[model samples]
Target: MKLYISLLLAAICCNWALAQSDPLTVATFNIRYDNPNDDPHTWDNRKDVVANLILFHEFDIFGIQEGLSHQVNDLDVRLPDHDFVGVGRDDGAEEGEYTAIFYNRTKFKVQESDTFWLAPETDHPNKGWDAALPRICTWAKITSVNAGQTFYVFNTHFDHRGVEARNQSARLILEKIEEINTESLPVILTGDFNVGQETEAYQLLRTAPGMKDTFDAAEIVYANNGTTNSFDITTSTERIIDHIFVSEKINVQKYGILTDTYHSRFPSDHFPVMAVVNW
Candidate 1:
């Protein structure tokens, strides 16, 4: 009996050590705007599925794009125990689609949060360089309760129509990253870029300034079929316009694209992407 007890204690210690090595999982999802025309696939029809996706995967930090005020509120009500940092792109309040940053409340303590428009009038809700509508980035500074590590998260959606606006928005975000990540703290930038990896904007994100694409830096890409699937239910893209970029401080263990469906319907038009990383 004493030998059995000692063996059990040793096994427990080994398991605890292995658990401590597990990487933090971060995800990026574009829940598709709440369009009234999307009748059968409207937010009401699939909000629960989307919420369940996050809960099932147990993401520590995630970014969302194209979420309106009511949509954001719905997720908050459904996926309780998580807090968000964001503002409406139209008026910096409960006005327009929000590119929000969400963190699991039980896993982290919020330090600071901010939102800035991607425009000349960045301090206000305004369009820039022919952008079809106002666009913005929501950010947060949070510390992990489990690991005691702190990092900055910036989430945004670039204009889908204007090429110049997209390029400039990339530059603008880079400048902000440099300013706020002054100490070169671990940083994460995720979004729906609406451009493929070949574009100048994506090239800048991939190369200059040391921000590593989680997919590129991962030691193992366990998943990653693709990131976007149109609402047609039959269409999907390998262009993978959406992405997650992490600072060099992170060691990416695995990268995946969550392509899940309920019955035959999808939770959103885009497949959520994720990265399992350790600092």
Candidate 2:
């Protein structure tokens, strides 16, 4: 009986080990709206600086919130090696803000892409919510170039105001996950949730079956207590608002919040969060 128990335990340990060896890296950044408040230190003026920091990270996939069409285009031009997809937050007009995703073209091929609005009556593609102008969540199906594996990546920015919108947005995202991700492929949901670790949206996402927060999983390995901070234009106090959540099927390797204050005078109000994972 003791020998049988030992054999079973060893087998479980080996399986767990295998599960943790898959390789991938992802990042989420909430680039605050282009405001003059950050003048002389704005993203517009420091595109090279922002692109340099992003390229230095060498992320396989990157999701950006509060991106405007021109900004996205600028990133595409700067990071010519990456492929991106995202529509404007206000219909197909490309006038309002956006939540965009960029993937290294050499690392992954974009299979599909789409955007959804977050309002209660969000039938259209991009419509403003009650509190903020308009919010969007972008989804992308990407095929890994090396492993040839496919996965679903979803990114969104919740309404800063309207508690109902945030809660409902959580539910809506979960429902969409179930509806779209039927293949059981690995998934990474990244974005600025706009709520803390204690909020209902956070609870729902963290507790969801088959889903796990990368921060919780990698905390044991990395000593990064601060994962994000988009507010506070002056001092940039460290507060975690951005997140990178992955399915249980995915293995989290390392995670950290990028706080490179030198290069980023004011690239965005929020710092970007990154994670390395395997599946």
* Candidate of highest TM-score: 1
Off by over 4 Å in 2: 1-22, 123-130, 219-238, 263-266
- How many steric overlaps does candidate 1 have? 0
Model 2 lDDT per residue over 11-102, tens place: 99886665456467799987766777777757667667678878898877989887788778888898978988887877745877778889
Predicted structure 2: lDDT: 0.79
**Model 2 CA RMSD to the hidden true structure, in angstroms:** 5.3
lDDT string for model 1 (103-178, tens) is 8898888798889988877899899997898989988888888667788999999999999999999999999989
Q: Could you estimate the TM-score for every candidate?
A: 0.91, 0.86
Clashes of each: 0, 3
Query: Considering every candidate listed, which one attains the maximal lDDT?
Result: 1
